[model samples]
Target: MNSNQQNSDHWLVRPSTIRGLWIGGSILLALTVFLQFFIKIKGYFVVDGWLGFGAVFGFLCCVAMVLVAKGLGRFIKRDDNFYQGGNSDD
Candidate 1:
């Protein structure tokens, strides 16, 4: 019945875990961008050859997807008790 019941001092909720995750992600992003200089793109798209292009593209795509999902949620979302005819306790 309590919100903290699930967390219960889990490591995932700790500050160290959050900091480590961000650091790891940044390192991976930087490494991939650095490698893009020597890696030639065989694709027809010119922007694909630019450094950090993939990361930017992927990030933009993710943002667009989240925006679209949020927009659609307004029309598709239902009340928590919509399936139970408003009697959620049942």
Candidate 2:
């Protein structure tokens, strides 16, 4: 095989990248689990501990963010002609 092909085939997946992903995912999972047990809103409109509420809330927030981003893209998105010839149609 050529040097280029060999290099491509043997490209390093750094341990740091793997470790970072594992740690990040673990933390998110742990937070969701922890929040499930210890989440309580004290005061008016208070909600007592509801199992899996944290995970559900987090998932719903993610979904809402994605939907909002998609909706905003339609209004705020621009073509390559944006900012050309001092035409700031933003």
Candidate 3:
């Protein structure tokens, strides 16, 4: 490695690549939702029949999981030095 030369960055970490990925993912998500208009969806529940319900429900579920995990973390977390010393008694 040359001291004066810059290190090569990964393609996935590049800002342009990240923006392109976001654009592609958004297009795919929109296409799936738009296709629902042409197809007959046999939803098990009434709420599932609403347009964009899947996307909304999925997003809400993810948020709920994050909240639950954060709450649980409070109860389970240990101090930074919890394991620093072999014995609890100094």
Candidate 4:
């Protein structure tokens, strides 16, 4: 590849950069969860006021959404040759 093509690659694609990003993100997430101890959360529900509740809830919700999407995909997905047939109506 030419110099321009080499330089065009995004920084996020690099292994070192990706590792650094993961570390930075983890630190930020930990900091937020740690702050929950000092900051009083005015939660509507008693369970939500617990330590790291928001993070756990958010992670669980994301997993549930992924599972729902996978389940829906099973019934809604079409075959690979669905649009490659001989007739337009088929």
Candidate 5:
């Protein structure tokens, strides 16, 4: 195969992968919205508001945590060979 053909193929998303992600995302979104109706945990620190708002707040908090983790991983990652030949006792 030519280099250009290989590169174009690398950039393509498989149909199954796209379908799986779409199905997974829809399920998660449904579960998030559904949980608000059927589940309640007592909180010592309650923000005075509607119950639906609390679920939205929790979802946002989860998203924020994911973003923070991604940022930290990028910031703290080392090159693959960073310590490959280093002397431990130096």
Candidate 6:
């Protein structure tokens, strides 16, 4: 198929739309963090007062996961046709 046909028709496909969405979402998240101080989080652990802690934690966790996956891939990756032609007797 042609490039145009292969592309999706999603609303945020355009750069301007995606930029606007990112700006809007950042504003909304900032507002949420600003409003969080007045409220108390009944968590078993402290650091609840830290604004955007959850977002930071989740982002860091995902980055660490990707790094770990890449490190593991070095050990776990196999050559091409490893399963197709090799080890057929086993």
Q: Pick the candidate with the highest lDDT.
A: 4
| Order of models, best TM-score first | 4, 3, 1, 6, 2, 5
Residue-level lDDT of model 1, residues 1-90, one tens digit each, is 365875676888777888999999999999988887788656568877677888999999999999999999988999887766754565
lDDT of each residue in 17-43, candidate 4, tens digit only: 889999998999899999998999988
lDDT of 6 by residue, 1-90 (tens): 566854665767766788999999999878877777887656556774476777678779999999999999998999987868855666
lDDT of each: 0.83, 0.69, 0.86, 0.91, 0.74, 0.78
- Top TM-score hit: 4
Evaluate residue 14 in candidate 5 and report its C-alpha lDDT on the 0 to 100 scale.
52
lDDT of 4: 0.91
Question: lDDT score, residue 4, model 4?
Answer: 88
The estimated TM-scores of all candidates read 0.70, 0.49, 0.76, 0.79, 0.42, 0.59
Model with the higher TM-score, candidate 1 or 5: 1
Worst 10 residues of 2 by lDDT: 40-49
Q: Tell me the lDDT of model 6 at 57.
A: 80
Tens-digit lDDT string for candidate 2 (1-90): 676765566334555667888899989888777775565534333432455555667789999999999999988999877757575566
Number of clashes in every candidate structure? 0, 0, 0, 0, 0, 0
Could you tell me the TM-score of candidate 2? 0.49
What does candidate 3's lDDT look like per residue over 1-90, in tens digits?
A: 453332376778767889999999999889989998998777899889888888889889999999999999999999998878766665
TM-score of 6: 0.59
2 versus 6: better lDDT goes to = 6
In terms of lDDT, model 1 sits at: 0.83
The lDDT-based order of candidates, best leading, equals 4, 3, 1, 6, 5, 2
User: Could you tell me how far off, in angstroms, the CA of residue 75 lies in candidate 4 after the best superposition?
Assistant: 1.5
lDDT of 5 by residue, 1-90 (tens): 676765566333755667888899879877866786677745556663345665578779999999999999999999999978777875
